[model samples]
Structures are given as C-alpha cells and as structure tokens.
Target: DLDGDGDCEILYGSSDGKVYVMDHLGQELSGWPQSSKADLQGRYGFVVSPSVGDIDGDGALEIVCGTLAGHLYAWELDGSVISGFPQYVGRSAKSVCAVVDIDDADDAAEIIVHGGKSELWAMKGNGTALSGYPLELGGDEDEFDSWIFASSPIVLDLELDGSLQIAVGSTSGEVYVFNTDGSVVDGWPVATGDWVYSTVTPVDLDGDYEPEIVVASADGKVHAWNAAGEVVAGFPVTLDAPVYGSVAAADMTGDGANELVVASSSGAVYMINKDGNFMSGWPTSPSATTFASPIIIDVNNDGALDVVLGAQNSALQAWSRNGELILSQVHEAGDWIDGTAVASDIDKDGLVELVFGAYDGKVYVIDLDTPATDANLAWPAFRGDRVRGADAVSTDSDQDELPDAFEMAQFNGLEQSGADDFDLDGVSNANEWIAGTNAASASDFFSVQLSYLPGEPSASRRVRLTWNGVAGRCYTSWQCGQLDEGEEWELADPESGTIDCESTGEMSHEFDVSADDCFFRISVTR
Candidate 1:
C-alpha cells in the first residue's frame, strides 16, 4: 500500500490486542499472530486506521495501533507482537500512528495520536516515551463535546523540512502542527469554521513536493491553507447547506493539476480546479446525502483520475476522473456509511485500489483496475502561473543548473532545483544580465543584450535600441556575468527583426548567439 504495490494488506487492530494483516484480497498475511492473544488488546474495536512502519529496521513494516481499551499495540509483519504496549501518555484512549525517521536519524519516526479527554501524546521509536512526557495538541476544552478527534491527523513536511510533521484538525475549527521533537510549530484556533468536520487534506496541486492543506468548514465553506496555515483561496457552496461535510484534494486531470472534491451535508458533491483562477467545473456531482470524503481512484482503468464517494445511507458513487458517473454501490452493513476513503495499490499489481472504512466497523476494498499513475506529472498546485492565490513563479525560475524550484518559484521555466545558470557559475542568467553587465558578450564584461520575448506584438509603437560605440575594436567582447541588480535594457536584433538595426541608432553586427532568443540592445563598454 505504501508505493502502489497493489497489496491490500489488512491494517486493522482488534480489541483482542492483536494487529491483523491480510493482503488487499483479504488473505491473512497474519502480521502479528500472537497479537490476537495479547491481554493488552482490550475487548473492543480499534476504530482508528492502522499506522504501519518498521520501527526496528527489521525489514518488516509493523503496525502501531491504539484501541478504545486505552492501550497501544506494536505488531510485527511476521505476526510477532512486541512484548509490552507503549504507555499511552494521553489521559484517555484516542488514535495513534507511526512515521519513519521524523528527525532524520536511523531511528524511526516518533508516534503520536489524539482523543481521550482533550489531549495529545508523543513517543520515540522502539516504544521509548518522549522525555517531556505526552504532549497534547488540541482537545475539546468542552467535556463530552460533540467529538474530540474530527479526523485522523494528516502528515506533511510543512516547513519544507525533509522531516515530516503532523497536521491535526479539531471539531472546534482548529488546525495544529507539531515537529517530531514534540514541539508545536503553529496552532490556530480559528483554522476552520464551526463543524470543520472533515480532515485537512494535503496535496501539492502545482507540482511542488510540498503539500497544501484543504479543510471543509461547517461554515458551509471550503478553505485552502498554504503551509503557513494562511487561508489562500476558497469557495462557498449554496446547496447542501453551509455545514462543511468533508473534503479531498488530488490531481484528477492527467495535466498535473489537482482538483478539489468536497462533499456536503446535503449529500452534494463539488469539484474545482486551479486554473489561473478558481474554476468549479466538475462534470459530475451526486445529489445524495454524502457526508464522507471522496477519494481519487482510477476506477475505469483508463489511467485517468476517478472520483469515489461513500454516501450516507445511499449507494456508493463512483465517477471517472473526468466526472462520468460509473457505479452506484450499496453495502450490506451500511450504518453511518463510509467513514473515510484512501487509495492504495493494496493488491500490489501496479494498479491502485480504493480502501475505505465503514461505520459498520468493516473495511471495503474496491479495485480501480486503471494503469499505474504517472507520478512524474505535475500536480495542479505545481503547475500554472499562480500559487495558492497569488501569482506563482515557475519551478525553474532561473534556468540555471540550480533550479528555481528550490526557491519554489519560477524564473522563466526553471524550477528552484532546476534553475539554469547561463554563466554555469551559480548566478542566475537573469541576475547576471539584469544589471546590464552584458551577459550576451563574455569578454567585454560590460555588454549585455536586451531581448524581446517570444511573440510580443509589434503594433504597440516600436522603439529602437541604440548604444554608443566602444572606444577601440569594433568587435570587442562584452558581458561579465556580474551585473548589479535592477539594471535593464532593450535592444533589437536586426537579423531576427527583434531589433531593426536598419533604423537610426540601431547597431548592426552579426549576433554571436542569435535565433534562439531575440535581442533588443547590446551594452558596449567602449
């Protein structure tokens, strides 16, 4: 399930104190055989999704699960249960999950979960309790509050930190984040409006590896948050009332851009894409009572994104990535209906399958027979001219060897990581030439070319480029690649029609690097 392996491993915990593992087909891999017999398993159901990872580096991914019985279970891939349960620092039973090397060390990521009387807890890998004791993030200060944990915590690298951090949302309309060291990075009490019941989905729509947070608020509005927790862009729904039901974010378009799918209390489904402006163009929406979140799947096996919604008391609705309704499903034990749906290649056949939880306490598996997704495609957030809400730079801002994607913006088409340094020396070509040191001519160290971009209209009143002649040689070299900042010029290339040298003050000379890009004016040191 980790990497589209198409293996539907049963990642569930029983109150019986045992963690059970089965392939996507529901065959017993029996991860922790003895776990079934653990007295610590408690005699109830483990409602939380199984947190799977190999904390001991034994090459086997283990299960770290919590039970309503107030115990934490660590089950191994080979069906071997850890001897003792890690202390649940929280005062009450809640949810739990484990991440890998959160601190960037050989040690696995620490474990943390919420619930149980408004509290949070953190622990080191190998069951070592954190030194500062269990840390509580957001709990309903109001006891017996309608709910404590709105949804399972979503994890992403918010700080662009290689290490992943956890984002937890509360029924009180709060969003909180914490580092692996049990430190709170930022906490906002007004994150979402009342009843922001849905989990904050993290997706990088614009091809940025960093994911953006999307939350559905009871205010009947959906708000998109940047990594800093600022509300970037959002849309309000008129139907299904204002109570935000649930929200999911993903790139349904093979174009690398992501679309947002939101389910409302009125059972209405909505879809939107980040197209220059916020575009709400979902070709599909079921007017059923759909409170659960919709998951992105390749159901038709068309290799395109599909939408699947677990309806409330209604049949499950499946739509192709393009919004073509395909399936209307009914479950045998449909109670509250679909609780949560996440996609995975549980079968490990290179195709992703939909894995969702039902209020009936049973997990449903649906095969999405589509071809493996092309991970290389840019997500909605990673593409286009705008980000979150403002104008977005390209991933490669500088076209230098060092990409602008590292800067997380665009300078032309280069990404910070893929920015090209025309000088091949680290300085951006724009930076080198902007100061007007003449990036076009190398030896002169004082000449640069002014270029008109591709396809600029000449009807806007043409202006001619002019430069004084050099003191000596007519063909002296220019461009030092070390121009000061904020310098600019415009020159026309007679050959490319970019610069009509035939006009007055237009210097005429054969261009050394012409045709690829247009030129306006050339700086002459003489």
Candidate 2:
C-alpha cells in the first residue's frame, strides 16, 4: 500500500537483522528479502515497525524507520535507499516517527521523530534538520522516560488554517502545541497529574468544524482539551485503572454523537458518551492488558464501530459496540503482543485488514472476516495526515507499467500483472512489449520464413526471408552448415540489413548460401 502499486505490503523489521516487505497474502516482494540490514551496512538492528509516506512527492511512497544504532532511514518501495537518508541522530531509546508537511517549502515532507532524548526533531526529506529543531521539552534526562517511549507527535490543523500544526504530549504531564515554525501556541502546555504516555487524539465533539484534543494520561483519566488549552466541560473522565493506551472516538451506537472509547492497564474497556458519562452494559473485560491503541471499526458491519486490539494475553480480539466478543485470534501458545495496531484496506480488495507487530519478532496482518465498504481513517493518530483526517491515497489505481486505459486494451481487461501470460504463450505480458506483438493472441509471435532459390552452377544460392516486422526490433538471420558439423552460425545478409520497421507488414531479406546443407535461423532482438 505504501508504494500505491495497487497492493498493500506488510512492512516490518525482524530479528534476522532485516526489513521485510510482504504482500497481503504474506508473500515477500522481490528485492526485499533483507532490505534494511543490507542498506545499513550491518551497523544497527531495527526493532520498530516502519511508517510510509511519499516524501519526495514522486507519486511513490517511501518507508521510514529508525535503527537501534540511533539512525533513521528512508527506503523506496523497491528496497533502494532514499538519497540523504540513514541520518545519524544519536542514541535513542525508541525512535518512533511520522512524516508531516510542516511547511510546503520543498517537494517532499519532513520526518518528525520523538527521540529518546525527550526532544522532538524535524528534518527535511533529505535528512537535514529544519532551522529551529530538536525542540526540548524540559524532561529529566532519563533513559526510560515513558513519554519518550509512548508519546508520539500528532499532526493536525488546530486553527483550521490551510497549513498544519503539531500537538505533542510529554512525560512532564503537559501537552504542548506548536505552529509549523516551532513557535509555541498561546495558552501553553496544559498539565495533568501524572505522565502523559498516550498520544493526543483530536475529536470535534461539538461539530464546530474545529477539533478538540482528547488525550489519555497515566493518571487513570481521559481528558479533553480545546485548542485554547482549556479542559472540556465534562472535565477529566475517570477510568478504573491507569489509562496507558490512547482513546478512539466513534459513534458506536449510530447516535450521530460520537463516544469516547478507552482501554486500561487492568484489562478493561470503557465507552464514555460525549458528555463524559459511561455507557450502559458497561466495561467489557477481555482479561488482557494493552498499551497498544484501540481501533474503532465496524467489525460486524452493523453501522456501529467495533473495538479491535492485541493484548498481553497473546490474543487479538474484536468486540461489538454492545460489548459482545466477535472475533478472537491467538498467536503461538503464549507469545505476547508488542506494538500498536492499525486497520486499513491494504489489499485494495475492498476489504480491511488488521495489522500489528508482535513480541515474537513478526508483523501480522489479520484480514477481517467482513468486507470493508469504504476506506477507514482508522490510522487517525500517529501516522495520519497533518491536515486531512486520513492519509492521501495513491492516485495510480493500476500499478502496471502500462497506463490504465492502455493496459485495459492491451490485456483486454484490468488488474493485470507482468507475471501473467494471457495469450498462453511462452512470453509473459511484459515480455510481449519487446516484439510489439498482440499480448491477447498467441498466434502473433515474431517469426521469419526462409526460402531458397538455386541459380546456375556458377551462380551463388539465393535465400529469401520474410517476416511480419515489428517497430524498434532488430531482425537478424544466421546461417550454418551441417547441423552436427560444429559449424558456427554466421550473420546472413538481409536485403534491408537491420530494419527499424515503422509498421506491421511483411519484411523480406535475401542471403546467398555458400555451404552445403546450410541452415538458417531468423531472430529478433530489441
């Protein structure tokens, strides 16, 4: 999906010291068996999942990730290194990142990282930092700050301007907002009682076209704050336990008004109405703790968003709005889950799939049993758009080298791959372009017919050759004597020598045969 090649690829780093890109069916793409480690020159290992963005605006997406060696890298879909990447950003505890168009000053976007140093750094797509970056948030220089590990920058247009704004929460229990130029917003960092590990999730509860920031803190409460740094009327909504995972907003009951969904470290799920009151049939217990953010999608296709997440109990579960368990999938006997989960239509098959990483060193994609009728903004927090609610979809609907209309006529249909041989000919659809033959018909191969005319005893033999010539293809005829005589084939003379045929028509060539039992073979080379 990152490449917009009309297919979704599962991208992740593994213990094998490599970055793996697999197709929707778990098949690895070519040129990607060990893309990352090899590109890094074996300098560091990758532990976190990679993010995707078309940083160069080249109509193709690039995958970005950080290494344990304190460096960040951007890779092309074909597994090639992006120029000026693998930037050495110093030591980092967890370098989770997102791409944003902080300012439309370049052809690409900036790579924003919440480094282990308890600071946020913004770099141009080419690996150079902006003028005033590495913004410090005044946190003690602790190696394991929960905020550094959990708090990621969210890009949104808080002022409803055409440009983007950045919102980040810190270990100091304060949420900070900044203009794209790195200047602080008016009412300053809003404070909470404890650490703010949850990334900010913006929801416009009052339908004002302006979104209110909803953030969960380790203080066992979910708080909503306006852009002006004032808490919403309902104040901080209390949870049964410490709220580590971020909350998701969706109208679960189809009531037009959205509900706040939060999960705690104590293995419980709570749904709070817009007014900050708990919903009926209350907290569903799945018996597993999760730090991974909860995703809201209609798992039952009942027009209400369902809850989906992986848990410490080694299971990925989905629950209905009414707190009924709909799907439960398990990993190996007792392995735990490691990262956050994202849901999207990755396969382009019109169905959504759930994606997440695991402690056992693997990335998983679980195709939901239900078909997705539309694209989901389920990835609305970390890597979502800087202004738009969701990431932009690649405009290239057909990934074939041939444009959509041309491929449709050439292959006589859609969704064609280079690997398919539609004409049942030995040549694949891609290879057919070499001879400019009809890919839909097996009878139209590049072939040559040879004919010989013997003259008087003193005269040389005349060999006439004819073929349906193709444009841009070079035709050659070779002659050899005695099939088993070890006679080497020599280039035969064509009437037109080498032709760059301008159209599809009969072409003729003549060569004089000198040796007995001479055989000729005609070949075309592009």
Candidate 3:
C-alpha cells in the first residue's frame, strides 16, 4: 500500500476524468480523486487502466496513467503531481502504460505506452521522452493504411539474454517484437490475420526457459508462437467468438504446465492446455458479455485454482479449474467492470481480496476465504503482476556491478569494466551507478556547492549547501572545524539523520553557521 501500512489501497481512474485512492474499508484516502480535467486543462477521462511503480528511483510509489485526451500523468502517493508530468503524447492513449526499467543505468523505470494512432512512446520517469522513442509503428503519418495500436505492450526477455524486448499488437492484425533500441526483432511483426486487441502473454510451455508468445485476436483464434516466430504446431485454435481482452496463464490443473485462460466478448471463459486443446467441462458462460481478462487464483481456499473475471452484466464471477461455477461467490457491481481484477491480501489478514473498478465510478474490494499465499499463485493477477502491465527482466549477465542493459546501451556490449571511468569522468562506473549520474558525461558528475543566505541574524548566519542529487538516493551533509587530514566530519544536522532526494534536481540543506571556522561537504549514500 502507498503508506506501507500492510493494507492495500485501491487506486483507479474513472470515466469522469478523476483518479482515486481508497483504503481497504472503502474510505477515500485524503488528497485523492485527482482530476485530470483540471490537470490537463480539458475534459478527459481514462479509458485504459492505471499502473503504479516507483517511477523515480524513490522508494515511494507513483501512480502513472494516461487520459483519453492523450496526456500521460504521474502523481505522488499523496496525489500531488510529479514535476514534468501531464506530458501531451497524442490524440489519445487507449492502452495501459507499462512502467519498466528499460534503462538500467540509473535504476529508474520508463513509462511505455501507445500514444494512439501510429505512435509508441517510451517516456522516462521524469516525463521526458526517452531518446530514440515515440517510434512510429505504421510508417508515414499520411498513409491511409496506418495501423492503430490498442493492445497494451508487454516487456520480457524473450531470448533469455538478460535484456528486455517489447511486444505489442496493432489493429493491423500484426504482433511486433522490438529491441530496446526500437529496432524490430527478426521474425516479428508477424501477421495474425485479424485485429489483435489482446496483450501478448508469455509462457514457457516447452520448459525451454524462454517464454513462448500467446495472443488472441478478433479473428476468433488463439495463436501460439515460439521464440523463433514460428507458429506452434496444433496451430491457431479457432473459437466461437473474438477475444477482446488479454489471456491469463497459470498451472490451473497442478500438472506443472500453464493453462491459458481466455474470456471472450461473448461472455464465455475457456481453458486451453499447453497442447492447444480445450480443457474438459470447458466454455463456461459467466455473463452475457465480458471485456475483462480473467485472473487465476484459489478463491475458495479449495487447493485448486479458480478463474475470476468481471462482465458487462456488472457481475464478478468465479469458476473452478475444471470449469464448474463457484455458486456462492458472485459479486455484483453498480456498473460494468471492463477492466481486469487484481488479487492481494489487502488487510494483512489471511484471506485474499479481489479489487477492480467499474463504470459507475466506484472501486470494489471483495474479501475471500482463500489463503493469503494464493496471492502468489502463478499469473494470479492481470498482466501477471499487480504493479505494471508487463514484467521487466534485469540481470547482471557478466557478474559486473552494472546491468547488462546499461552496458549494452552505453558500450554496445559488456566490454567496459564497472571499475573504469568510461567517459574519462572522475567517477567510476560503480559510483556513477550509485549516484545515478551519466558515466559517459563528465559534466553530469555529482558535486555540491555552498552559499550564504542573503539575509540572516549576524550572530548565527545561515549557510546552505546544494548538490546535484538523484531521486531516492540518500545523502548526508557533514561539517568539520578544519580541513586537516585527521579532522572528523560530523553530521551537519544530527537531528535529521539523512536527507532523501525526492526528485532529480538541486537538493539542499540549510543550517545556522557555526561560531568558528568550519568546512562543509555532502556525501551520497544508499
């Protein structure tokens, strides 16, 4: 939860252009119901879901979401707008934004989202566009055949190379896989023969370590493709209706193999085994129509996974792994639940709770008797996790202190040593990593400056020390009577143990000048 109180807080965006945060008891948190209409200076609301993560390296989480008017906003836990946010991307942002560490140099995450039409944007946590991004998917904007991206993008290490690859679908019926550099991966942009509205789900079906891509389309088919982009045998399984939402995978049968859970717009929920065959007692209809993806969890503490999904009939339904309806578990909402539901042990209690938002501008948190451990079930929530729409894989392949993605982006490979100063900057790569500064830019190194306030009581003059700081990085200001070699450096403000940099900018600390000659310095800490 935002306050680290152990009870999960429900965060959601409504059609009225407001974002809200509420406690588990359904009480609205203070400084919430943030209005996008006022923030963006227009009438707009969220059509896609909101994602939460520490956009900055700060330990505190920030809410990231886009509006139908095409502005992307980032807010602090208290509903305060982050500096450099409400970035205008395009005409509309209809897909969920994926917050991930695409760049590992600073340990900060990037916000990846479809900027409507042919644009795909990669924005840094500071709300600035990442270089080489906002890549045009369909080429020239004037082309009449340009594709529109509606499906949310997923990030994964498809090749198990420690670097993430982005996979997303378009209205042109094609699924694209791209390297972090924005180059299309070989054997990708594969045609699906119909519009793809579902985000690609990655599952290691053959125990190959690398995940296989599984996605459904308006063609009424579920297509499976290996890492090589070749269609898996048993082929595109045809269904009775088109799939509009994403597919969820989990070990529903406890056979150590994942079962694909699909909820179609026709209100049917089907479970297909890894063999591309439908499970027994399949195709259970929970409601008349459903645009929400199903989540697999043990809702009744029955030792077996249950499929949970919301429907246009304003009801949340649950069914056993074998497709039998959980008769006593239906929960109705005031309006349609078009978005996917997330499960967690919200109240720090042993039981898990299902949380989702509805068209009536209300968020519901339904408690269940299931064990809290069920929250860790494989693919328990939408997009495989509760924080983001996709998973970001980061690793140090060569045992270096720097991440593989950082080395690859800066040196084209892992050829540079973390102990060396790559750009001839005074700071080593390791220190640069800690300071979240650019190792390749000498001018970007961290340092501090001291200055005296313009006006203050002559008896105890005030002095301020400012430093270039990174968000989430802790710093300590020190002072010493003299610059002697053995002089001890004590905390400038002992009462305040450490200073937390809330944002990447000038971080300063002020204190009354000492009665005698003193020296001041700033040191960066973890």
Candidate 4:
C-alpha cells in the first residue's frame, strides 16, 4: 500500500501482462492497472509477485516485479514506472525477490531477484547491478539438469554475526547460503533429493542463539542445517507428500525448544520436535491441500504458540500448539489460497484477524476471535495439573472412579471408592468415610439407635448417636420431630460425649429424645 492507512492495497502481477494496484475493496487505484504489454505484448507474461519496499527512501514504498521476458521493473504507487527500470537480467525472474540490505551499507535496500535457471542477481534501488553482479546459485547453465531458483531468498544472520546472509533454494534440490558479496558459505549448497519451492526459514531451533536454516523440499522432506552447513541431527524428516510451503519454528510445546512446522501438498501440517520426532496429535490435515507457509502466534493469548495457515480448499485454519484444530473458516468459493495468512490485531481488537491472497485474484481478511481451548483440553489432565502426566492415560491400569496414577498419591491405594468395605464395617468403602467410621474395623461404625433404659432408676427414652471423631473434624447431630412433612433437621444438643482411643479409634455422643417420634442424622465437617 502507498501508506499505512489501516487498509492495505493489493499489488499483484498477472499472467495477462498487467500490474494492477487495488485496495482491499478490490477497486483499482486512480491511474493504476498498469501493464508491460508495450515491452513484450504477446511474447511473455508475469509469473512472480511484486515486491514492495521504500527503494528511494521516499517514505512511500515502490512495487517491483519481474516479467516472463526476464525484465524487472519498479513502479511508483501511481503506476508510474520508475525510470531506468525494466532491466533485462535473464530469461525470466519468476521467484519472489526479497528486498533487503544485502550489502549492509544501510543506504537503501537491494533487491535479490531469482534469475530462473540463470543466476541469482542483486540489484541496487535504481536498477543497477551490485558489484558482484549475479552468482551461479543453482544448476550449471547449458546442462541437461540445470536448476532454477524457484524459491524466494531469505535474509538472516546464520552465524549470529552482525552481518546477515542470504539463504535460497533451487529446483535442483540444492540449498545455498551466500555471504553479502555473493560468495558461497564454507559448506553451503547442500543438496536434497528433490526440488525446493518453499522459502527457507532461519530459526534457532535449539535456542542456541545461532539461527539454523530450515527448508521444505519437494521430495516430501524437511531439512535443517546449522551455521556450518551440517545437517542437524534427526533432520530431513519425511512427510506424506511434497512440501511446497515454507517451514516455521516456534516453541509449540512450551518447552522452550522450538518445533519445526511445515505444510505439504497433501494438506497435512506437521509439528516436529527438535529431536525430529512427530509431536503427539500432529500431522493434522486441515484441508485437502495446504501450500502456504504456516504462521505461528498465541492466537488465544495462550502461553503456548498456535498455528494459522491457509489451505488450497479456500479455507483458513488455526490450530493449538498441541496440533488440535481450534478454528477454521472458508474464505472463498473456488479460489484457493496461495500466500501465508498474516495474523495480527488489525482492528486494535484483542483477537487477531487473518489476511491473505488467493488464486482467484482476491485478498481476504478473516476474523479469528474464537476463544482458545485450554491447551490441556487438547490432550488430557492426568491428576488436574496440565503440564505433567502426558502418559497418564495409558498408565491408568485401573479404569475405576480414580485413575491408578493418583491412587498412590491420595491414599496407599487402600481408600478405594468401590462398594467393597475393607474394614469389615457395615458401612461400605464409600459410605464409611462420610459416616465417621473406620473402614478397617467393624466396631468403629457410626450408629444411631433408640433405647428404653427401664432397668435404670431414672429410665427415659433416649436417642443415641455414636461415631469416631477425627481430631480436626466436627460432627453435628441433627434431629427432626417427624420426617413426614419433610421438615428441616435441627442441630441436637447431646446430653453427653466421650472419646476412647485406647480400645479402638472410637468416639461417641448421646442425646435424649424429647419427642415421641424423631429422626436423627449426623453431618461431618472439617
């Protein structure tokens, strides 16, 4: 867009030889819908997207794109082609060029254009070639297996040095990391077995502060390389289908260790750990195909990062860090998405919205306000704590009221809640505790009885309540005049109470019945 006006314009190039500048509403700019028809009318077309940057430091970004005729052009916001542009570099420059400060001069950003089977070129803002000119980053020319630089160039600091390096992939399955002078790194140009159409991502997968290169090759594998160009341990993990989307890294498991996330042509999204193992509940298939790189964010404000990506099925989906699908929305009817769906709080709202471009010549802005599921809910809680007990499910040998995992924790696996009474007391195992009785002893049971002590000199009908009292527990005896009216039970004042721990763990209380008919109950509280 010409300015950050809260709405962005689409700077798109088409095979019809046109460069249209349209807003989010799909309306063309005043003098836009420009074209390269005059230069190569029926000869070539545009296959690469226009790269935007402030080439002249004019505060306004300019649009740059390469035509199928190998001509690169930069245009102003008003569709005026920047003079001295449309420079012919090679046969074609189809891959998206990265606008970066490759020379580190800080004067202006240089354009890294892919020369499609020719060479990788670095051009100044005014269309002049850099000092090193173009470098042979792909296959050799005039060869049967000459490779094409079909992937975009990524600029990052590989060695954590002050200077940045350029990482790009070729159709010949070679991954090259080049210094700013267009020179290859020490052990670079690593070769995979297949083509690489996805952009390379440099991330600190092991939290070493030094970035590692991660690339998704068309041979259905994801490879990671350290700064020295050595394959990272357990890398090049195989997937089901060819992966065309760029790889992303984040602490998906909240382990402080980053996981490599990549999508494939078969619509599968994989979250591989640093040790190259598939995370539990991963390789999720959100759509039939996912070609765009996945974007990682804490969409639900979750401490763990989540994933957001576009699918070829015209839908945008978001997944939890544990690989559970959280939310999804179909954005287009028939147009499949081709670009990464950017996530941000576009409306200043807490929830982020997803924005992306599609194959139907339209851009989409989808709202993603769905509340994030508790990360543990995506898996399971072993004993109530979310972080641990990941394997509690299988370790639960007894499928009863309480899992065997926490059995040893609460009790010695003796306080079972089943029907069997362990103390030989009349109260069952479940009822013994509530009745203030010892499940290990028959004499320590809670009892309420009515007795007529006619043999005593002062005979009176008495209601007796007896129960074993714990030191910190208070037991209240309640009585109702009649149970027919569903009357409330009132606390009963005991005539006497006694504790005898010598013979058994026993305590007792007695209450004289004042009414002819009475119901009694005991309530325990700690």
| Candidate 2 C-alpha lDDT tens digits along 316-406 | 7777778777755333314566456766677777766777777766667767655553323332233322112113211112334332222
Pairs that clash in candidate 4? 423-439, 423-440
The 10-residue segment of model 2 with minimum total lDDT is: 387-396
Whole-model lDDT, candidate 3?
0.76
Best by lDDT: 3
The TM-score of predicted model 2 comes to 0.67
Better of 1 and 2 by TM-score: 2
Ranking by TM-score: 3, 2, 4, 1
Clashes of each: 89, 2, 0, 2
Error of 3 at 308 (Å): 0.7
**Top candidate when judged by TM-score against the true structure:** 3
What TM-score should be assigned to candidate 3? 0.71
lDDT of 2: 0.66
Q: How many backbone clashes does candidate 2 have?
A: 2
**What lDDT would each prediction earn against the true structure?**
0.49, 0.66, 0.76, 0.64
Off by over 4 Å in 2: 15-17, 33-47, 93-95, 142-148, 327-334, 375-526
Greater TM-score among 1 and 3 belongs to 3
